[model samples]
Target: MFPTSRIPLMGGLSKMSSSLMANVVHTPSILNSRSTYILERARPLPRIYPRQRKRPYMNRSTYVYKVVQQPYDRLMRQQDLQVILVQYVEGLGKAGDIVTVNPNYAYNNLLLPKLAIYASPENLANASLYKKSAEEEAYSSKTSKTLMRLLPYHTIPVVLNQDNEWTIEPWHIKASARKVGIHVLNEASIQIPGPPIRGPDQSLHGKDFIAIFKVNNKETIKMRCKIFIWATKPAERNSIENQFWCFKGEPVHPEEKDDLDLLPIEQFNPDKIIIPSGDLENTIVCAS
Candidate 1:
């Protein structure tokens, strides 16, 4: 009775244990109810974040070039060449028939020194008679002035290969088209604008006029040409197709006609034609 005021600590511990047991028994239903409420209110993840899909990469397109070939069956007509020489002739005799001048005549005489042959006496007599009957006109005088102007030789004709890789030098003038492998139509001297002494030092070379032909079973060919010539003048770059003739022998002036035929250097096509650039000193190509 005298110590009754102090309640035992054992009683408090027992009470706390009882309360915890009650909470454990009732807590299951409470937790189930909370879970139901959460299920109703919860939201799903964003659509973008669900699954990552890779985008396909794109590629650039390419283009191709096409080359067209012509039909081999296409035919070209060829005609025989008839040489017409118009020169200051003393007369036409058996001995005066077309004579070829020696190439050395130019050096010997100034321009051309070579002499193929001299006019015979009989030819001289005929020439004298013809001269007497016809009106005395100067040899330099233009005969058939209108027709002479129309002559093909007055303008040179040149054909260019595909790709325009090859071009004639002395590129100032343009060439007219003439029958292949034939006499120059108009045979007039090219007119130089300035004095004779002040002409261009660099004319197209005889060797630059390249000719291609087929040979024998050995697949041989010939080219009568020299190496390519570069332009000394800047303006000449566009003038590559100028008409110029290359002969085997010395070139004849419009006033002189002493050649029966012109010799040409010929070569096989594709196999023999070549163009090299930039100090090509050691490249010596021989063609037959």
Candidate 2:
């Protein structure tokens, strides 16, 4: 009953849809003909999650540095600098002495300051005749390297005035050190790394405090110093026996255990003195 032209139009529509259905039925076979990787972007992606965070810089257990060591000769050629002192460079070397130093230090501090010169044949020849300057002459005698060797073993005693509100000062220590033949000429070089000892605190008495001393400009030396409050009263004064300036651990105050005596109050005895801790004696030994 339809017109011939309209019939062909309907048939064409049905034929096209049937072709689409056929292709759908064969979809797996068609896809198999093409590469599987094409559908998957490239290949199967790795098993990493969508977003991963990194550990904090400070919290990281591993560092990303590698050490590469070179030959000693190579390092000496590059990093080390040979110099001759035109003037004395304290802590480095004296004039006329050929010395090796850091390249940067040789350039900036020595060469730039005119304190030193490069080691040349002509300069090396003349270096031996150079005498130490006046300042160097004076200083060398005062602060000797011997002091560094001696100071570590001995505890320098600094006596402070009792009943005075004075805090420990460097000058008070310098005076005490000089008497013991330790040449601490400059008070500026001394530093107390401990808390201030103000007034006459009995708890602080006979306690060894650490003091740091700067040697030259480059080296540091540490010494132990015991601060003792000068006893103004006779009974409270340091006993003439058993302990000289300080007791073994703590001082037994006369009020606490004078005659009640749990601690020994042994009398001073200077023998031919084969004892382990013999009494300190003034002996006349004639060394012929």
Best by lDDT: 2
Q: Taking the tens digit of each residue's C-alpha lDDT, what string does model 1 give over 1-288?
A: 223224332212444444444433333233312221111213333345336675433223212223232222122112222111223333321211343343343234322322222344554445433332123433322233322333322222232332234433322222322223223233232232211211122343322232222211112122222223445444443232211222232232322222213322232344433442322221221110
lDDT of 2 by residue, 200-245 (tens): 7767666556567777644466665666666666456543223332
lDDT of each candidate versus the true structure: 0.29, 0.54
TM-scores of all models?
0.17, 0.39
Give the runs in model 1 whose Cα sits over 4 Å from its true position: 1-198, 201-230, 233-252, 255-260, 278-288
